[model samples]
Target chain A: MTYTGHLQLEASERYGKSVLSDAYYNGVFKISRPTYTDENLPLVQLIHVGGGYVDGDTYLTEIHVKNMAKLAVTTQASTKVYKTPHKQVMQRALYKLEANTELHMKQDPLIAYKDARFTQETEVHMDQSASFFFTDSVTPGWSKEGTLFPFTCITSKLKVYQNGRLVIFDHLRLKPDEDLMQLLQLEGNTHVGSLFFIHSEVTVEWIQKLRDYLASFCDDQYGVSLLQIPGVCLRILAKRTSLIEKIFAAVEEFIHSTIYNRSAISWRK
Target chain B: MAMTNALFPILQLSDSQFPSGAFSHSFGLETYISNGTINSSASFRKVLEIFLANQFVYTDGLACRLAYEGLEIGNLEQLWQLDQSLYALGMARETREGNRRIGDRFVKIVSTLYPNQVFDQYNMELKNKNVFGHSALVFAIVSKHLGIERETAISSYGFATASSLVQNAVRGVPLGQTEGQKILVDIQPLLTDIVNRIMLLDETEFGIGAPGLEIAQMQHEAIDVRLFMS
Candidate 1:
């Protein structure tokens, strides 16, 4: 089945209290009502009614955060791409953030089962003052025969634009057909995780701290580097899925405690 | 076949002694050596092949091709966009900085020698710090400016990149100079093969994934002592 999800979020201030003025979603996507903590932060969970994607599926999601609003969007569960023999699955998302707004997308990992071909493209358009923290992981599902990473292909591309100029364009396409164990490819890793933080307020100290935090995990191979823009990009590769999950958890906590000066709550079911 | 007038320019730019500061950075080879990961000839060759097939062939080759096309159409805006895209594709900070440094140096030297209006405009952009000047793009721009054919320009670039890494391996991995030459000879066929492949590559295939090599370059920054910049 073909699925397309669209969401638009706007903020309104009444009596000096920030509220979700407009929260809308269409098609196979659903979002929980905003649960505001003491700081008026809205935590929204994106839900897929059909659980996962199949052949010839197309999904598009648009998110807009108005000025001075803070929002975080995550999935209800991992996105699974089942085997596709006839056609590929495609997903695209666009995020627009106005000035002084922040959007954090701590999405669950995308799992591609054997022979599954999946393509995802996400682009962010924001002002210079806006901030974004985005993360995504990719792990292949095992086959009945116990083989791993048997998926046909996975293409994921991310681009960030500020003031109409492209600042970051990250594209990763893995076709595990040849030389997969080489030093330049996955290096025998079964799971990969990537995190991008683009905020004008980020500092060198935060980057270093994040690097140290990533280094503390000995089971995985990770790296933290400053992006060309005012932000950092972290990449982690490990054999076990839990290792990358742990890294993501730590990263979410670090951003919460260090950058936001708040504590992160567990949203896991 | 008639000899091309651009042949000399291609040869000159392809020379290692052209002084683009290409030798100063090892492009993460130092880290592999420091970690004792690439100490033998076979290992060095394997890693070099990985570098070519996985990282350099896609990233640098595609950027170079795009820059050449952008310049051919005299589209400075397109060139700027391509530069930004190439910069964004770099996952390691040092890789980004190092490429910019080298590109800046190449433009500085070649622009002075050639002194063309196109080169001047690009130099102005670089001077104004509007966009990051990457090595591959600069190489392409200069090659195009010098009237070099696209195929010759790209193949020369592939060879130069391979030679630079091989030479660094000779020094870092401490491989015998003969062993280094042999390794280069072994990979000689791949130069044409990769350049041919890159020539036909689509823009969608521009930045093929190389997560392991990227992490290694990033880890290069944290090593206590570093011989090369990247």
Candidate 2:
């Protein structure tokens, strides 16, 4: 069966507290109640009610935040692209943030099973005052045929913009059935992770600390750089999925503690 | 005669003394030198070969090809998009800035030498901050203006990049002048292969996946003392 999902979130400041003024979702997508951390940031989890995607599944997510709203969005669990012998699975996401607003999207890595074809595209539109934090990851899933990286293909494109001017564009395409290591330089690694934090508030001190932190504990191939615009972007390739997750979590915690002066809440599944 | 005529312009643009400001930038090779990852001429040659095969062609070469197509069609929007893509793909701040500076200067020179409406439009967009001027894109525009063949244009840019990297290595690595020349000679076949292969690549094949090289560049930013810009 084909599935198409839509989500729209409009957040605004009211009574000295930022709240979700409008939330909408259709089809197979659902969201939980907002949880606040010490920083008073509202956090929500996007749940795929259908559990996983099959052949020919299409999902779309649209998010927006107005002035003074601080929000974090994450997935309930990893997105699973099951074996598809016929058609491909596609997902599209769009985010818009206005002045004095911030949105952090911590997406769980996509797990592609054998014969699966998954495609994803995400675009961020932001005002100069708005900051965006986003993460995207992909890992090979278990295959019944006992082959590593058995998935047919996975393609993902991410773009960032400030006031309609594109700041960054990244595209990743992996065809495991082919010689993936030689072409894209996966280097015999199975997991790929990327983090992007775009904000005018990113300072030199922050960059230094972040650089030091990444250098301190990395054992796999990883890169952390200040984007041409404001903010930082980190890209990692690892052999294990858990390692990527730990690295991202550590970086997020460091950012929260240093910038927000608050401890990041340790969320439980 | 036609081939030799095309060769002259290619040689002029790709010359090491072209004042493109590329010599001041190591394109991430400085970090490798400082970290001892590329100490010897042999290691340097290996890294350059891998860089050309894995990263440079996919990113810069593809951008140049796309830019040529955009100019050929006279599509300002396409040119703008190509510039944006190339700029954004460069996550390192110095790398992106270097590209912007070199590209802008290249266009300025081309405009003065041979004024054209497309170059003017690109300049206007750059002035308006609508697009980040990338070196590869500007080179494509200049090549088109000079009537350079598409294959020759792309190959010349590749040769220039490889040459600049070698020049930087000679200074940064403190390699002997003869050693640097030998390294360049060693990579000629690889450069030819890469140039040929890059021409066959589709737009989607352009990507970023060389973490070791990228990480070296990222770490270059935080190093207390640095010789090259990136």
Error of 2 at B196 (Å): 4.8
Residue-wise lDDT of candidate 2 within B69-142, one digit each (tens)? 87788777887888887888787777778878887787777667657777889889989987767767767877
Chain B TM-score of all predictions, in order?
0.92, 0.92
**Considering only N, C-alpha and C atoms within 3 Å, which residue pairs clash in candidate 2?**
none
> What level of docking quality does candidate 1 show?
high
Strongest candidate by DockQ: 1
**Model 1: number of backbone collisions:** 1
Cα lDDT of candidate 2 equals: 0.80
iRMS, candidate 2, in Å: value is: 3.0
What residue runs in model 2 are displaced by over 4 Å at the alpha carbon? A144-148, A177-184, A213-221, B1-4, B113-115, B173-200, B204-209
Off by over 4 Å in 1: A1-3, A11-17, A217-219, B1-5
True contacts recovered per prediction: 0.81, 0.55
Best by TM-score: 1
Top-lDDT candidate index: 1
